[model samples]
Target chain A: MRRAIGLILLLVLAAFLVSGMLLVHPFGAPYPTDMDDYIIENAQNQTGSNSVVASVVFDYRGLDTLGEATILFTAVTGVLLLLRAQKRKEGGS
Target chain B: MLSKIVRTVANQLVLFILIFGLYVIAHGHLTPGGGFQGGAVVVSGVVMLLVAFSSQDLKKSVRERVLSIMESTGALIFAILGFAGLGTVFFYNFLVGSPIFGRIPPTGPNSGDFWTGGFIPLMNFAVGLKVIAGLSAVVLAIALFARGEEMEE
Candidate 1:
């Protein structure tokens, strides 16, 4: 019974993923490109950055980058916590 | 640990890997690669070193404390840079028209400038440092723990 339920869940997830992929726009032709056009045209002038992608990532959407950095910080902290060295008892043996 | 031949090759290759990673990080604003890619590259170099040497040798050279410190410093720098733009808005490009990193380029394709992309290059460097330190520390910890487990057996 558990295996049956697991299979059903997996099938449901696959269906959702397939439907989503089917609904996505075709390659190289994204819908609602106004923002893209604007950024492409004015990124260099506004941000003074030659790389449009960099300007958008670091300047326009910088808060997202901050959040990404925070997530990385949290992950590193978790690793340190988990792998920290534990002291051995001197006389336990 | 691997043989002496593998260790020698890794030692020689590590320098080139580090230099390439630095190049990618520094030229992120003007080139294709960015901080994440460059940092991963650097971490790969560290991994190569780790694989080539014993855990004891790795511990002597690469300390967990140093990597932790580097991670913290990178995060702090990133946060400070973000908060520095609070005068106008969050993450404002204040250095765009100023002296530092304030060189505007032509619209179309041309040779890019080094002194452009206000706050971008700095952020890239910070993120790069964070990723390299964090990943290397994690791998080092895991390797050390595995070695400890072997000793217990």
Candidate 2:
């Protein structure tokens, strides 16, 4: 019975994934590229960066990058906290 | 642990890898890679060192405190740069018209100027430093713990 239920769940997940994939637009044919076109055309002039992707990431969407940096900082803090050696007290139990 | 031959090769190649990573980070505004990519490359070099050498030897050279300081400094620098633009807007391109990193490029594709991109390059450098220090510190911490575990066994 357990195996049967697991198989049913797997089948349901596969059906959902397949349906989602089918609904995706065809490769290299994206819809509503107005934003893309605008960024490509004016990124260099506005951001003064030759790399459009860099301008978009660092200039246009700066807050998102800041958040990513914060996440990395928090992760490092967690790692340090978990791995640091513990010191024993002489008087305490 | 790796063999002596692997260790020697890693030691010799580490410098080149680090230089390449720095180049990528510095030229991020004009090239394909940015802060994250360049920082990952640097971390890969550090990982190579960690794999080639013993934890004891690594501890002698690279300290956890130094890496932690670097990580914090990078984050602080990024936040400060953002705040500098607070008069206009959050993350504003305040340096665009200024002398530093303010050279506006032509509309079409061409070779990029180094002193352009306003605050973008600065932000990239900050992020790159943060990623390099953070990831290397994490790996170093894990490696140290693993060494302790082995010693316990």
Candidate 3:
């Protein structure tokens, strides 16, 4: 019974994914291009960057970048702290 | 640590890799790549060196303290830049009209200039530095651990 239910769930997920893809806008031509259009129109003059994507990442959505940096820093710190602790234990014995 | 040929190739290739990474980071405002992507490229090169010369040899030069300092510097700069724009709003592109990196590109398609991008390029460089240092330190730690050794202090 459990295996049958799992199979049915997997099939349902696959059907949803396929149907969603089929109904979605084709490739790069997304339906909601309002945000894209706005950025492309003013990014160069406003941010003074030729690359719209960079302008978006570093200027328009800078808080997102800040959060990403924080995550990376936190991860690196955790790894270093754990590794250093192991090293200390190794040295003591 | 591998063959002599591998070591020699890595020695010659590392410089070019560094140059390419810088190019990506520097031209971030005008090109497809940016801080995170360029930093990943540079870290890949560092990993190449680590494999070619052994982590034990590489860690001697790549101090964890220095990396930690660099990461802190990048994060600090990012925060400061955000705060600087609080006169209008956060990340307000304050340098758009000032002398430094303030040249607006011609509308539509045109050749890109380096003396533009307001604070984006600077932010790119900062993030690139943070990523390169942070990731290299992590990789070095992992490599040393794999060999049942700890990174040098």
Candidate 4:
């Protein structure tokens, strides 16, 4: 009885997972565009260059990238701190 | 270890790829590929170098902290450019209009040259340096960590 219940639960979870994957949109579908479209369209006025991604990264989404860099810095600092003590332990070993 | 003939060919091919990567990085603003893509390609060459020379030989060449600092400094510079832009046009592009430490391109609005007095080119070099260093650091860390795992095994 217990084995049957477990198998039923597993089957239900597998069904849900397969259905979720199948519901994803395919390529070439007309998706709704976001604020990035308008930004790219007007990037010429702002940066005087044809590179839209550069305009977006350096000018428009600058603050977001700044925050991301800060996060990377913190993570690296943490790794260094963790490894520093490990080196000391290894030296004693 | 690769055979002698294969190793020689790989080494020559890697050098050529590295040169092409450098060209892509240097002419990023005026060309198609930018720093990150070029940096990754360069780092792949570095990876090939590691594969050719082995980890024991690679230790004397690459250091960890220096690469970390390079990556962090690149981020710092990009942030500084952001702040400078904010000061002028409140998040405007190329608003600072000053000599940005290094060579500022002598192109302007009327000059029809995309290489202008903005920090784009400088930022590309910084990002290229940062990404190359960062990726090599990762490869180094993984190599070391995996060595430990192999020892355990």
Candidate 5:
């Protein structure tokens, strides 16, 4: 059938897409710039704390932490609401 | 008897653990430990008490009302602290102020003091209480509700 031929063509296209990624990674080189060093130097100067990751999380990326906390709060609220018991009718009939 | 002695020891141990957990939460900013860990530890102590004594017996010591209030108030304090930091810097690290909000010495050391810091220790204690109460409520509710008899819903 024509559908079988179309499926084969799609499979070939998928194979090409996956194989293309293998060709790109080997030749890629990483370049280290002076800006990276300056960033480290300035961070040390401003925040007395030596913990770069903590500084980034609590200070520079604080908005991200706030958003994450809001997401957690929302999820907890949703779970609590779902778990709450529903009121039933009082009459025994 | 042996059971009586075991119960006495367990009670004392649970109390000590709870106090240590609170200390960890209180000194979180200065020390390596913080709220979540301390809260979990405190809840473990609560679990110990529940296990050593019956659930009904444990209920006599700590009420649901107190736990719920602790949770809600902790959340409120956390929100207030968030707003307090908005004046200076973003989440400006409010763990550097005095215990009584705006008191003498304009707070304490830069980053080393345990009692110092704006709202860090308070927030830690609040979060500790909140987590312990919330988790204990969840576990207690589940345990009670799963008893085969139909609950009021």
Candidate 6:
């Protein structure tokens, strides 16, 4: 029973991934492009960036980048702290 | 350390990898890659160097304190840029029309110019620094730990 369920789930995910790569738009063929269209059209002129993706990431979605940077910082600090403790124990003993 | 031939090859390739990574970060506003992607590329090169030279040799040079400072600097620059546009709003494109890194191109796709993106290039550089320092430190620590050694505290 578990094997069958796992196989079905894997097939579903694989289909979704392949379809995405093939650019197969879903049922509602063209969803509202209101925001997407505006950004695509104006991102270059408004942000003075050649790469639309860069503009969206660093300008349009700057807060998200800030959050990501914070996460990286925290994770690195955590790793260093944990490792240092291991070193300390070795020395202490 | 690996064979002498492998060590020589890694040493030769390291500079090119660093250059390519910097190019990706520098032209981020004009290219497909950004800081994280470029930093990952650079880190891969570093890993190759580590494998070729051994973790002990790397520990001698890749000081943890310096890496920590670099990571902090990158984060500081990112935060400062975010706050610089506080007049209009947080993370505003305040440099859109200024003389420095603010030259809007013709609408639609065109040949990319370096000095076009407002503060994005700066942000790219900041993030690139952060990723390079933070990830290298983590990887170096792990490599040392595995070999029963401690990184310089």
Chain A TM-score, each candidate: 0.78, 0.84, 0.79, 0.59, 0.55, 0.61
For each candidate, what TM-score against the reference? Answer: 0.90, 0.91, 0.92, 0.68, 0.61, 0.87
Residues A57-88, candidate 4: write the lDDT tens digits: 55577566556556655665555444332433
Clash numbers, per candidate: 0, 0, 0, 0, 8, 0
Report the candidate with higher DockQ, 2 versus 6: 6
Which residue pairs in candidate 1 have backbone atoms (N, alpha carbon, C) closer than 3 angstroms, thus clashing?
none
> Candidates sorted by lDDT, descending order?
6, 3, 2, 1, 4, 5
Superior candidate under DockQ, 2 versus 5 = 2
Candidate 4 lDDT over B1-153, as tens digits, reads 567876787779988988888877765545566667788889998888778776655656766767777878877776666666665654455543544422233333233344542565666676677667767766766665566521111
RMSD in Å for all candidates: 3.4, 3.4, 2.5, 6.0, 7.7, 3.9
Native-referenced DockQ of model 4: 0.15
Q: Model 6, B18-104: lDDT tens per residue? A: 999999999999989989888888998989999999999998888999999999999999999999999989899889899989999
True contacts recovered per prediction: 0.80, 0.86, 0.83, 0.08, 0.05, 0.90
- Give the chain B TM-score for each candidate: 0.94, 0.93, 0.96, 0.73, 0.76, 0.97
What value does the lDDT take at residue B61 in candidate 5?
Answer: 64
Model 3: DockQ score: 0.74
Interface RMSD of each: 4.1, 4.0, 1.3, 6.4, 6.1, 1.0
Best by lDDT: 6
Q: What is the lDDT of residue B116 in candidate 1?
A: 89
Which stretches of candidate 5 lie above 4 Å from their native place? A1-93, B1-5, B94-111, B148-153
Give the per-residue lDDT of model 5 (tens digit) for A1-93.
Answer: 899999999999999998997766465563564755554554333433233443343345556644544454455445445455555476556
The best-first sequence of candidates by DockQ reads 3, 6, 2, 1, 4, 5
* Model 3: per-residue Cα lDDT over B49-125, one tens digit each: 98899988887887888988998998889888889999998888888877889898898888999999999988999
- Over B11-45, each residue of candidate 2 has an lDDT whose tens digit, in order, gives 99999999999989988899999889999999999
**Model 3 alpha-carbon drift over 4 Å, by segment:** A87-93
By the lDDT metric, which is better: model 2 or model 3? 3
Model 4, stretches more than 4 Å misplaced?
A1-34, A70-93, B26-32, B89-91, B95-117, B149-153
